[model samples]
Target: MMITSYADSALSLLPPVVAIVLAVVTRKVLLSLGLGIIAGVILLTDFSFTGAASHLVSTVTSLVWDDGALNAWNLQIIGFLVVLGVITALITVSGSARAFADWAHQRIRNKRDAKLMTMFLGCVVFIDDYFNSIVVGSIARPITDRYHISRAKLAYLLDSTAAPVCVISPVSSWGAYIIALIGGILTAHGFADTGHLSVFLQMVPMNFYAIFALLLLLCVAIFGLDIGPMRQHERNAQKGELFDESKGLPPGATADLPEADTGKIMGLFLPIFVLVAATIYFMVSTGADALAGEGLPFSVLGAFENTEVSESLFYGSLVGLVVTIALTMQQKISTSMMFTGIKVGAKSMLPAIYILLFAWTIASVIGELETGKYMASLATGNIPFALLPAVLFLLAGLTAFSTGTSWGTFGIMLPIAADMAMGSDSTMMLPMLAAVLSGAVFGDHCSPISDTTILSSTGASCHHLDHVMTQLPYAIIVAVISIVGYTVLGFSGSVAMGFITCSVLFVLAILGLKIATK
Candidate 1:
């Protein structure tokens, strides 16, 4: 049955609002998302119970098998997650994690150093947010654990860095996607002479939220600036509690993995190096193949624009898994123990996989409801030109927060923002576009159903809600600062002034938090 869109109606907002409220209240992500999906289907089916049931089944089936074939992108991401889990398990069982921890302990003497290292690693792995989210956590977790850093804090560092870094980096998957969109938007607006890359580069400086968020992360790491629930988590960690025991281990984490005494640091470091190297190689290779298929010449930027990120991640992770297995064998781990690691690792990812599946399904339902479209529509008409950047930022943030997909929010809001800018003052285009990018990342950081948010918690072995609750205050602080920055830019027409204002405000905010907390 074909479902009609509720995009023109206020009811379009109901599903996501329900989902967000329930997720917060119940602290059951899957249940919240399931009900949200059902709620959307009911609205689409005019409250027919049987119709809602059938629609739900069809919607889920379509996620796995779309357009008469398997949904390769979704499946590949799932494959990568499982493979990464196995790699993590293998390293733990082989004692590579312990060895790496011992090595790190020698160098990283305090929580501050451990956090700064995690932030540094996160910035270094800016190729893709998903890869960064998990890989950085896998490598840095041992060090942070050794320093008694709370899992929530580690997850915050990972989550805050992942999207903020990706959204701003020119060579990253997020950048490629956004540049492609901007190219089309520019041409459509009769700015065919303007280079898309140039516009993207200029906009990078104007992306207040992303820059401020990263700076705030640095301040938190350097100054031990913990506020809100995060401070409690940090206090608990100092008392030898890294997480709430009642919440259980995070998905894709196992507490009982046997650590071998003979584990070497190379066992961990080698596999991770291979993972990053192989993934970058595959990303470029696949991108080049795509360029060739399109009868276009190869360039690094072009390859990135054409690359299949999920496919590259899957292949790279598979290679990493093979290397990990070989290293485990060399360490003389028992065959039975290795097999147990495989089983445990694969099984551990199920909860996360389930949550992701539900999140995707609800996202799809919300799409059908035209939730983002409705939200984006609100930003249209009769707006003062100076306030355009700040308005777009808020709208994009709301759309992404409701949908739980920054990319989806980008798709929905970028064209609308472009049209608005073209219709008004073309001079405000780059700043407006930058605001959309910044807001999407900010919103994704706060969203419980966001994939990066989920993976960050999994990577740090923290309860998903614990990560969400702890990170909310920090995200809000950055977002508020971003809004003020954009407002200043809009009124002053100076990107530098706006950024300087944001920076000053951010420093003051950090200092204020430190003093208040003290």
Candidate 2:
């Protein structure tokens, strides 16, 4: 029953394949993930039904309790989500969201302006994707709704901006994580003198997908370009159907809750401002604490590299919830009504919480299966130097898509990419690494089981499947252009040429979509 024995085998890929296929066909995320977990456990237990059941129980419990202690990271993230949900509910019940929407309606005259505002918020909240996805969606949803923009489209805006922005920002959590990993890779490859932050910054321009995805999102928002399933959603939104009601209410939805007429814009803006400020403060403080413990000097980058993201998020959200509750009370809302908001808010998050739990569990199982290892192995043994970047991008994308995690993909593929470049083409190291970063983001962006994707849908109050299906074509288009960029970089050895290629292709793709839709 040692799963490592099958790490390099084709069998390692089965669980995610089954899960993804079932999700696409059935549109039942829990069912797909549940079956996927069963599939993984079955593989681990060597087809022993009893062993599989036991393993499954242990895996589920392990999320909360692992290694004789509570799993603080996972629990804190869950806590953050719950608290944020409550804050969202309080905001809605106090009529702050409605007030802000009404206020914006007078200034922002159309769907394009509403979406552009969402995109702008998404970029500004670049500290963490989780924060960006949820907060931006909450802030923008009412305005977008008033402008007749589809929930799915709003989710797309939230998602396309969240990870893509975070992954590139040096001050963000994703940047810290990636930079630390790059430092290790550089050390291992005997480039210890090189600055990790510099390398990350260099990779920023080389991250074709992230750059182009953001551009594409801007185009979609400003030019009103809708592609594939997105077109249908936008059309429906124009007809006053923002989302398919048959799919049930999405997470963070407050439509059924009563709104107080006394609500003010400060009710929404103040709590959100507090949440953002508190989260950033905690991030720097925690990072500084960790650095001090290590006998190191305090620096912004170093602190970010050592910050506990989930813990910081949880603490900040708790503060945000407190402020929201106080604001609601100021509106003279009854205790019973406040409790109702709390209950409904917490309940609304259950679906996202459940999906995230299942995703984390299955991701763990996939790790044991060595799904990433097997996928990484395929990229070895004599790939053309000219195609290395493209191949690595594709491979990393595939690994991330299958595993539902970009961080996991980075851990697995970054080292391998370093080794590959060191062995045959030393000059390609940074580009190859950049390609992995782009690919990992691309894959995670598209994967239905990805936590960010789930949160994006939850934040926008859109059906998860609707968000996934609508966003896929757009992600793929950007990815394709990114592949071409990597390929050009691999061959031409010019970063500018590669980026230029992606930018040109991106513009063409957007224009073509604009024309075709017409």
Candidate 3:
């Protein structure tokens, strides 16, 4: 309040972005984000370095105490990891996951189908990327191996779909995060214009990264349109030249080898079915405004529905888990085996959890430093109006790639993106923000130090370095298309144009690849 004049200079460097660069350099996400947060806190205050340190600690304590304000996506990150661990254990102990794998291996004809279906299944499970990663790997590994699809490709597809699909879907976990993110923006600006939550909601369909990458995955699947380095990797994978099976797999073991008694395949399916039913129920309850009408205020199960909407996905996961546990006994799997899968699954998310706490620390610290408002004014002053989206995208991409974390990117980027929209068309803001998100996803998709990258390598049983080298070329190819798509979108006069142009480029890209292969 006293020195609003210093806000811009104070925000010369964003905390998360710095952490991202540091993470890439050091390969330590937690360390980078923590340091950045500390720096941001120091910058915001007028006090000495010691005073800044004291201020950050005090602010963090206050924010953490609020519980509700510790970033809206907190539970989604925490619960998804824990639940996935439990689900994995249960699915494995029941031998049901193995049966699903056996069925997939039997049906797939070749390596293309193997990787393709893994990607397809990833899209289908779009509600949560974390869920998608563990579940797809849990379900598709066997089929991938039948055709000798490299574990690397399988992990890439899983990693690819995890964020891309969610960011695009209205009812997805990504959508939930964005809504909360933009809602905070609306609150900050004191704007009541329906907050353009719907604007961003609408723009998801137009997001180039989400639309194009998915289409690319499909082309890889159906038409066998492998190209650039991904094709070379796939070829090498088949020859066993760049990969080895003797490493004995890693991370949430791929469902490639059969451990289940096939006759009871249906027995293994109950947990998955139950989980899906619970997710749909959760999505509706939380995003229930769409279902609400002029007269319908309270749901029939108002207490249950109300509980779901208030507590994020954590409450629903609890309910879903209980149902899964109860059903497990009916399936007659030993309790010990289910617990084992849960432990394994939870362990898988450890890296993400580490990044999350550090990210939170940094964002809160930065916020205390008044860096967001500072950067906003500077960007408004110096950057051209037309170039804003591209700038935001580059910033977001750089942060994500360096930090090896999309959520951390969101923590840093969303606030500034939201600030850019103030006093603007809002329609412009939505696509611009979407561009930022896609850019971050693109960066994480290929970042070697990223958790998903590690998980993909582990899930596919591919050597980590090889997966990085092979998948990078394809990531770059799509990134170029996305850049052009976003640029065109920046100039687009209407949201519809943005949507159509992005969709066309993606579809054409898919079709073009198919046609060229023939």
Candidate 4:
């Protein structure tokens, strides 16, 4: 199961490339992933057909169940998915979602308000991207649908805020991962005295993509700015066509909410409240062990620094599900009905679960191939210090796009970025680090193969490809601005001036996009 490195260069890239191409051409995520796995195994087995077939079987076995081993990361994620599915289904069956939608419909008069509110919800649930995407999508979809907003736009909002917000939030799951990576890197490079948390906070100002993305999304929602394919989708939505009917609504998406006088708004808000509270509490409790040696103060920040997010999400969601079921019982729902609803919800999530499993398997294949390591090695040659940030930005973006993961890219590139800065220019360290973080997010935002991307589509009930197409232009625009900002900051060595400049430029770009799209 341990694959350290690859002897063949061309073979390393073939797996992901094949996966990407197949997914795009066929629009079949599962098939594409399977083919990609087979191709990777074939290359790994020195092009022997029999060897490749056997390796593929073994890899799938380990990836799924792992030889009677109950403990597996893939299984953990799958369990989380099933629990989330049950929770969502229980909410829907209890008519809480319908009640909440009706309440939101009355308050939100226009598409602009609906979108802004959705964005607000996305911001509020910043603890984890997966949670944000699903919870926000579930709550906001009914409102957005009522206003004739395209599912593509909903997915974009969900996807953008999920990873982007989590990456920037100091206490989020994304923050924990980045801190661990940077901490290790800094320690190895003789910067052990500097706190990783401190370094991350310092880079916050220079995190142009995350900052700009937040502003841009808000502006776009408020200003009604629609451009590129998103514009067409918006136009169609205005005409009461949320999506092409031929494609049909995604699973878990309700085309119509039942008309009932019994549904209460509390049915919706109460479960969400419990879910959020439980998630935060679980994080603190699980992370309590991380603060064992620390004296007094009992820092909330410190607890977040060491929290096991996946475990927290799993347990927190289970608590939330149990609460939802209790509320359903209070509503006089039959036990059999609740069980049926759970089954329906889990079944609806089958597509998403399958895609997630395949994506993880492909990621494993690519990791074994050392594709990212090969790509990261390219940053070593002679390059101008001023352009180092820009180079790192582009490299990280490409690596994340190819790997379909930003966290994985961070693990691969942060050390290289840190080492490169340590060897040559120290001033370039923060900027280069920021570049890697931003670029990885940028790529993840746009990648069809990304887990967040799939989650967003599932949450919003939009077609997966539709979400990618609509969001790509926005991600690209922000990336271009981020590249420009990093390039200028690298040369000027002024984070404040560069940030202010980028902030203004981003707003202006939003304004221009508004006008041009109009």
Candidate 5:
């Protein structure tokens, strides 16, 4: 008899439990992760007793030594980081980010509209959070300030929308990752008939968190309902005390710097266009064989056959960095200033990168341990057959939230969730998979230590704590609605009907939010 909810399932969850406790106690992410990793090592030690240290040593060693170390996906993520560094360096040197502020200065009149526009900018980028934070923040900052919109709110809007919107959209790289992961899982579990992308698309409706959170953000933007810390930050910004979120900076301090970077703005925008064009072109050329080990060939479609979105951005950024630097020199920025930009960009980003690495490593550890089986067993044991879709939704959310990576969450839970859908005659799989994606995004949105959350704050140049504080209220509102939506979905009797109900409820909730906020 196969058992679910085995003791080992709890073992897999131990790391996150430790991380949260340590984060609470120390308030330092590095220390918290270090402690959590050490706890994992400790647990492995006890699991082996005499071979504990050896097992830990072997695991860490395998991370670097294993062929999986250079797996396409892992390399792609690392490559993306390199590109980010290069692009950020160029933006700072060219002062394009500053020029964007100057441009925004012309359009912004007051805080209310400033907040609204920030939300609009976040929605427009909808494909990737990485693009959302930096592109939107740098471009919109001036307008936000002109309207006396606090940096905190700017960060809130930017951070809030980035991950949530990406997870929900079908055309995004995010969409590809989750869909592909879930598809692979389903294939492993004997449901290999449906294409991964199609399965992923079907599930979008059930992803309550992503849908609901966006709903709340829209509502708040229109009506200006300040909830919790978000409201406090809004009030602070209105009084020109926005910069007060940081202990080190005085209010309106950037007012002193010769603040405009037209070149940086152009440089940033052009590269992004190039990157997107390259990504779309590659996706088209690759067809169905993407990430399936097709080697590079020079044919029009062949060039992109083996290429990934991460690779495209990585290469584009290398070109962009050189161009931005050359243009910066022509703009007569001193060599020292160029170097300073690199220093600042790198220094500012270290904490985020650290969090990314730790989060990635922890997720990797779970995969290595084959812990997903334990998790699946737990789900199968506790959830009723009829309510499987809703249960899958919760499982996906919990996994991603605990792991702090949406892709990883989908990868781990998809196989398990798909297997659970075996007895269902109704079309519940899509909703189940969507729940996985939406739930993962929800956790990533609020978690202070999540990579997207960290990046959004950094891009907005808002204090990290302030971004988390202000955005949490909006996140919670959507979560409440999403939870109700999912529970109703279990008994709604049909997928289409459930989706319609959810959509209507979401719309009404957003409208209600707008009315109350006003």
Candidate 6:
């Protein structure tokens, strides 16, 4: 129902490719993304400098007041990030996180246990990736540092769980978004009875990358399978050196304020527990109403299907922030001190906010350029049916990597995935859909410009480039396994056997890597 200004052409790929290349080469993430936006604007304006400048102004301005900025989903997510930042700051300044670290110090005794504990925390916060990365990094850094765990390792743990876990969780923000996208496509194609949530559940078993990534993370954590740059980083960490001095730590690393040791772990435990409970409550109640409004009988799963994930997350984060502030106040902290913490916390999110704006704007520009449609074209024609899922996986991975945005890649590829499967056997549909999801997350997991990657670095206080470099080898290993798994599934046409085959292979791969690294 939207009009695209540009015809589907090869030029649509240039903007994101330039952005990716520049980010990798320059190591200036913000600058690289900004240049990509400019390139996209120039392309959209027919290659006129004056036109591009004018269009850039209009587009950037509109993000503040119109489509990108005024969008309800966008606002909800933005509010959640700001409030989450404030809550993180409040806990840090109030010494709540420090108290929790002290409380955990006894339970998590060794370096391996510390890493495992961080991984557990990451898995627990599956409601939203943004929330997961920020909360886990903020809370676990002190604990990890106490055990000589490197910032790179912490970033990997944070990044690995943030997106991969959300993509698989049935009630998380990511699940809601994917359901909405897939539902719309299915409804349009006359599959009105094919519930999107049902399809999502079916695809969960086939989500190879997400499943394998978590398994691999567990292997790395429990077995200490440090390889490539991560091994060097871990070696440095054991010597009480967390980061390479030449690269320097990220700005605002001071967010981990010095602890006062009040020993009130409630400051940390209460806020997080409340955040999870509140988010679940909002998702259920909001989703219940949405389903009832449509006159559908409200099953528990149906309620989640209709929930407003972003709005619920915003409310949940806001409530959590309020509770954390009140807890800090009870510690006899001055009003000015609490407000100062809020300001510092909000300011900390500015870098992430900046990248998100440019990323969203570039995605909008790509949509207008019909980039997805152009890529979809490549999947058409007489291709071998047995290799379709594998091919689509690589294509989706490349698209997500180039753009540094998984949601954008999903939006672009999901329809094509569905359409291709529609022409063939219906059994292929879920695998194809799963492939798109897996591939998008795989690419996002590795991309330096990805918002989750940036947040992971910010949370862990690791250099952004170090996180990407260390995580890439791990991500690639899982990606290769997924590609082969999907290819075999496509040919065999057996989801159950495919699941067993991939699961066994994933385990074997992890064990092999663990031994190899040792």
* Residue range 1-518, candidate 6, lDDT tens digits: 12435547898887778777897799777788888888888888887899889878877776657743466777787787788778877888888777777788889899889988899999988877877887788789879988989999999999999999999887777887888888898897789898778888888989999988998999899888998999999999999988776755463365434444463888988997898789889988998999889999887667776788778889998889889978887888777777788888887767667777777777777767777668767888688999998889888887777667788889889998888888887768889999999999998998776778878887887877789999999999999888888888998997776667778888888779868887
Write down the lDDT of every candidate, Cα atoms only. Answer: 0.90, 0.92, 0.62, 0.81, 0.62, 0.82
lDDT for 238 (candidate 4): 88
Candidate 1, residue 49: Cα displacement in angstroms equals 1.5
lDDT of 6 at 328: 89
Q: After superposition, how far is residue 210 of candidate 1 from its true place, in Å?
A: 0.4
Cα deviation at 341, candidate 3, in Å, is 4.5
Residue clash pairs of candidate 4: none
Q: Per-prediction count of colliding residue pairs?
A: 0, 0, 11, 0, 7, 0
TM-score of 1: 0.98
Q: Give the TM-scores of the predictions, in the order they appear.
A: 0.98, 0.98, 0.69, 0.94, 0.81, 0.91
* Per-residue C-alpha lDDT of model 2 across residues 1-518, encoded as one tens digit per residue: 24545565799999999999999999999999999989998988888899989999999899999999999999999999889889988998898989999999999998889999999999999999998999898899889999899999999999999999999999999999999999999998899999888889988999999999999999889888898999999999999999988888877676688788888999999999999999999999999999999999999999999999999999999899889988898889988889989999999898899999999999989988999999999899678889999999999999999999999999999999999999988988999999999999999999998999999999998988899999999999999999999999999998999999998898789879989888
Candidate 4 deviant stretches above 4 angstroms? 1-10, 254-260, 290-298, 334-337
Give per-model CA RMSD. 1.2, 1.1, 6.3, 2.4, 4.9, 2.8
Per-residue lDDT of model 4, residues 122-142, tens digit only: 998998898899888888887
> What's the residue-level lDDT of 482 in candidate 1?
92
lDDT of 5 at 25: 67
C-alpha lDDT of residue 237 in model 6:
93
* Model 4: lowest-lDDT 10 consecutive positions: 251-260
Number of the top lDDT candidate: 2
Error of 5 at 72 (Å): 7.7
Candidate 5: lDDT over CA atoms? 0.62
The positional error of residue 33 in candidate 1, measured at the CA in angstroms, is 1.0
**For model 2, which pairs clash?**
none
lDDT of 3 by residue, 121-181 (tens): 7888876665567656766765775566666677667777777887776456566666666
Ranking by TM-score: 2, 1, 4, 6, 5, 3
